[model samples]
Target: MADALPWQQALWQQLASRRQHAHAYLLHGPAGIGKRQLAERLMALLLCQRPTATGACGQCKACQLLAARTHPDHFILEPEEVDKAIRVDQVRELVGFVTQTAQLGGRKVVLLEPAEAMNLNAANALLKSLEEPSGETVLLLVSHQPSRLLPTIKSRCQQQACPLPTRAQSLEWLAGQLPEMAAGEREESLALSAGSPLSALKLHEQGVLAMREQVVEGIKKLHKQQSSPSQLAEGWNGVPLLLLFDWFCDWAHIILRCQMAGEEVDLGAADMHKVLQYLARKSTPSQLLSLQDWLLAHRQKVLGKANLNRVLLLEALLVQWAGLGGKA
Candidate 1:
């Protein structure tokens, strides 16, 4: 994962040129735009016995050890299970690692990804290490939602923002990776990911477009009283809860934009634009706005692993959506 995305080359070069760097760096941005890979590359460069101007030497003993996941001086702290919180014990272990001298007599590197996943205890436990790590220790914190992190944690590290690639850049990169993908399909994937190339590829591969179509149609029927939340939930059980919420958030904005401006600004797909227009006509502007806020809040909840009954939550949201349009 040391391979940098095309858009990352300039930033990588800039970082490489620096003779001295901060003890810790917080790399943050939207999901799946290669923040982890960027962090890994930086770690490799820092730990490589013979680092070049651009990055890691790739042939040094240090580089080989890192490639083999046997680097004694390198540690990674992530949630034990996907979507679970990083507990305090994990951070405590990292603290011990921070105090120890680098086994290789080179720089010690630690990567803490999705830093927002650290619960209050875990976050607090890492503060001392972040504020004063051992000399030559480098901490790279990768986060998709930095806002959720404690202010103390964020304020300690030098922040490096990782922005989503431009639409054209993403399209070009995706085209290279997926040459057999249709032009329209590629565009759709990019749009779905909100300009995150890797995320778009995963969404397309997971067949989210087809699922989104179903969700949209479900919304239409629910608005007309032809469908119930349970019915739609049963149908959408296969769709990832976070992704379903993401699409709804996007559609909520699309409907609001169409109703207010008679055009789609954030959304692509001409057919979906027209469909959103129809829903915009049926739903009141105020309803869409409120629904958008609700969707956003719930999206965050989903990310935080809140104790939510999935079907019931979706049911409640859809019921509120169904109440939109016309006189009601």
Candidate 2:
């Protein structure tokens, strides 16, 4: 059986026992919180004829087929490309799969990862199937944002939420998983992960934990006027903007925590809090929210558009953040 997270084990057990109710389920949670992993585990359990009460029987023929990705009754619907919408045709194709005979002479499973990626037509198409699925076929829609799905879709399936681990739990888990990492590295990785262990592992594997430290240090130098915008931009030239946004969000969270506690914050090597405080003083909560919205919109706008200078854009955003009185 696939290893399930602690929060998921109970739900898996419950689902395993009551296998006769609904044929559709919505597994929703924050990004990188292992929603897909839980969905896959559930799929394996449902398809495993010899499943234990608690989980899948890993030695079964169905489990072997699933492991080899050759389970004839298993279907996965995902975006054709990164950042691309799941087309309506994909949903139509899934409809055909749902109507087919189960190759294992039992249940068929269709899993849609990031179901929110479905565009309007695609979502509506899938909603039709969810409204009335045939036979013992199980439709599992995995989403990071359940709110983005149509109300019709939301009402049709049993919704299950996967939550992030607590800070202490996450720390403990990381220590156990990454014993080779230094203490400081592990702590920073946990923080940068934003309570998601999988995200932490990915960041550690990509060497982004160290890269984030460098970026944080560079930002501090900018605040101290020890580094020029060009220098800062050059230092972070090829870094993923998503990582930059994550670092900034983490910095903001730290600042907010210190403000709430009315305690001195040791920004350590990256004291962007000075600038953050200046902006916070000049802006209300609503304004901060608006700034966040602008950042997200700008991120989408600049993702792959030509004729846009990334370094200049980054510099402009930093200057705008430093000068909150102006437009974001």
Candidate 3:
């Protein structure tokens, strides 16, 4: 049997007990949840020659092949490069693979991860395969954002939504993985990852807690007219662009919330309150809302692989932040 996550035990049992399984199963939910792991385990079960009620039998030839990463019946389709699109050519390759008989004479499994990354042509290509799937084959589409996928593709598959872990569950799993993390650090990481336990551990490993301080301080210095955005951007060039953009977006949301609700934001970051205060004092609610919209648009552009100059991007955003309440 595959090793299921503590939270995945029930879901695993439910899937394993299904009377009739769909050829295409669309597993989706919030990122950093366990959707990928669950899909992988399911794929193993389907490919295993000796799948039991629990799952795959470790002693089978199929299990050994998978363990060695040479399972003939299993295929993975994903972006070759990070943040790149899964192009139509890749889906064409998949079509060729599926038409051939299974090498192992068992079930064939294709795992498409981050299914939303497939470009329009690729998604359309996949739609045909989903509509007319081969016998004894399963296509598992793992998506973090199902809305971005074509409605036709979504309609062809049975959807399996992965639920976010509760606060207690997230903390419990995170503590087990990162026992060395300070209690406050764990809390902050969980908050920053939006309650995804695995993502919280990743944040802890990446030292985001420390880098966040520098980013916040840079924002503060800009607000005080004591720092240059270009210099700040240089200092943070290695930071993940999406993460930085998301933080700025969150900051804008907090400032807007403070103006409208008279409430302090609690992201569990050390200096969030001070940042919120600075933003609240300098920007009107309407101004922050506009900035929020801009940040969101740029975030989408970055995710779409826009080849922007990083320094200029940061400078533009920081300039907007610094000028949020100008009277002009």
TM-score of 1: 0.92
Distance from true location, Cα of 242 in model 1, Å: 2.1
> lDDT per residue, candidate 1, 1-328, as tens digits?
3777988888889999999989999999999799999999999999989888989989989999999999999999999997889999999999999999999999999999889999999999999999989878999999998999999999999999986688888999999988998988899878777789989888888896787788778776776768888899877887889988877777777788777887556655554665576677778888888888889888989999888898999888777766665422
Candidate 3 global lDDT: 0.83
| Pairs of colliding residues, candidate 3 | none
- Return the TM-score for each candidate structure: 0.92, 0.82, 0.94
lDDT per residue for candidate 3 within 1-328, as digits (tens), equals 3457787788888887765678999999988888888998998888878778888787899989998889888889999998889999999999887877898897889999989999999999988789887878899999988988889999999999876778888888888888887887888888888788887777777888887878988877776777877778888986788889988887787777778877664534457677677668877878887889899999988877678888899988887877874521
Candidate structures ordered by lDDT, highest first: 1, 3, 2
- The stretch of ten residues in a row with the least summed lDDT in candidate 2 is 299-308
TM accuracy, model 3: 0.94
Q: What C-alpha lDDT, on a 0 to 100 scale, does residue 253 get in candidate 1?
A: 78
Q: What's the CA error at residue 167 for candidate 3, in Å?
A: 1.2
